[model samples]
Target: MTTPNNTEHANIAVITGASSGLGEQFYETIAHRYPDLDEIWLIARRKERLEALAERYPNIRARVRALAFDLSAASSYDELSSMLAEEQPVVRVLINNAGFEREGLLRDMAPKDILAMIELNVMGMTMVNRVFLPYMRAGSFEVITGSVSSFAPIPWQTVYSASKAYTRFLARALHEEERKRGVNVLLMSPGNMNTEMNVQGTSTGKLGHLPYLDLKRETARTLMMAERGHATYTPMLFYKLYRLFAKLMPSALAVKVTSIENGDTHGR
Candidate 1:
């Protein structure tokens, strides 16, 4: 609740969606990997969850700041900007990981859900990057959590895929832009993982059968790739091959193939 002293030039890591899943994993990875960090900022909508996560690292060297902000709301960005101005901390790493997906046909999805996807996955992530990037000095790393769905137009997960495509392009472009400034921007396009966001259910259809990556290992690998100056990290050989296939195949055919592969035969 209390801000760190303004006079202290704390080296910090900022992680959005740090309440659970991959975001939580990123916190753990950063804690171990960057022991010199003076603070770790955990941003999410759930205050209690963020606090709980912070409590887990009580014995760690860095101070944990649990910032509960709903990134979908414009006010959250304003608040974060104010706090950053006050703290003026040196951002060692920034992870824009707050996003959600609602699986279904476009028409079947609620209007609010579609907008929410764009709000958080696209707008929220973009704003977080903008607000934090200035505080990140040379050698600081920024990671945008993309998805394998970004490779092509997926039928069932239409909005989620489209949003990730936005993230993919933005992150890659930023990588080039920031590289000149000696900052690294990494796009981590992970496939399905056993996280709360990817809970197994009947609606998952064929996606539930796909191989899931270990959250810890993949998170670690992503950080390693970023540290090595890689612009993007797509885990698992299967998804890697799929990315190639999506690139080589025609757009129309790829959409049709993905539709059928996911058991969506309504149009046919």
Candidate 2:
């Protein structure tokens, strides 16, 4: 296994989807709190945004790295691993936070968009964990962002919910496998938040109303808790309660509710 850098294992963090929202929040929070991180790698399709975020902190700016690539492609994992090997940073943390969803009836959804959802949300997430496992094993933490939707089937956002379900299961399985290796794996399931992903009009009408959502800052805190080896983290208290309620509803009924909740938005 590639060992972490000289810094303590508790600090370094690599976050995907770092150009926006919850991922950005995690990056900023850790950069401010963990000065010992030898390096922080921000991966996303948006290179310009990642660069801008890096510029904000002189210390992080010095050690921060960014990779702009479409992770939906399987080849991206190999390329990312190559880059990491070249840099040889002791990567103590890895965040699999990039994902997308399609909004519509399964039959009406664009074929390409559905494929893209699977590619990014499920395949890409698996690839990220696989490519980074060696580096992480040499470190202390790993976190995968799942969703509350993973608990039950979601109708209009069918494939997306399935994708998150895969991610959640993957995290749990990986955590069990890596416990002895000293790497802690956390699966973070946040209720809706105010992000472009859930914006009013762009796509995927899976946005939870503001009164019931957890902001990005709280999502970041939940991620931190998971980094400490918590099995799962639900950022919103109501979301946690909602999950409990969801468990009581029939799976079929729950799916209908989700379809209604997400009917208005389109795919990303």
Candidate 3:
């Protein structure tokens, strides 16, 4: 695979899961907003898709490096590290945007998909964050894609929501720790999006009509929030209130309510 040219001292943004969905949006956001960036490395399991995405940025595609590797696979981490060793790109932003969820009861969902949700969302994401921290420096930015479901128990999406809760808390704490070093971390917990992931998964009956925010709008909002150093950036006032309501409920009660409200979505 050919690496971007003159990458040794390039100001680069590393974005995972860039083959589609919100990951693609994040790629576009960075490319358009930071045209002066020396390079943007797009990582995903699909080389074809990554190539297609690169085509969209004709003016900068040559500077946009594409690496096809699955984030859920541990060996892929070694691949990334090796590339860093070879290219030594000066990383400016790291976007851990690769993750998935299934729409079904825990027992009914395919075991592999269920396990993959955990691996990619929680385990892999954490490891990715740690592996790259040493490369990040002051003025560097990071965004971890989370969800409103993180604020409460979301039945049917039980494991998915739980994983995001881990992301949300982890990002908040990481933000505090990395801030002293001048790195800004933002946990983007936006509501429903009209992306393939949400359209296919996210079995939230109560949130079926979740105000899917515009991709570009939310992307810009997220960056603005990060620039201002907001650690937990939840879009929409409605979700902010929803989070508060969930926090006010008893833990057991929240679970029970979640099961009753969204657990029945697989039927639809």
Q: List TM-score per model, in order.
A: 0.92, 0.87, 0.89
Kindly list the per-residue Cα lDDT of model 2 for residues 1-268, writing each as its tens digit: 2433544333347888888877888787778766777778888898899889878788553378777888998778778777666665555777789887666788987899889989999888988887777666534788888988798897777888899999989999988888877788888887665666566334333453433354546755765686677777876677787688788999878776666454555332
Go through the candidates in order and give each one's C-alpha lDDT. 0.84, 0.74, 0.79
lDDT tens digits by residue: candidate 3, 1-268: 2233443476788888788888899898888888778888898888998988877878763388788887888888887777776766667888888887765677878898888888898888887787676677778889888988788887777888888899998998999999998999999987777665456345456666457778888888888788778888878888888788888998788877665344333210
RMSD of every prediction: 4.2, 3.3, 4.1
Clashes of 3: 0
Order candidates by TM-score, high to low.
1, 3, 2
Query: In terms of lDDT, which candidate is stronger, 1 or 2?
Result: 1
Q: Rank the candidates by lDDT, best first.
A: 1, 3, 2
What TM-score, to 2 decimals, does candidate 1 have? 0.92
Report the Cα lDDT for residue 182, model 1. 84
Per model, how many backbone clashes are there? 0, 3, 0
Clashing pairs in 1: none
Between candidates 1 and 2, name the one with more favorable TM-score: 1
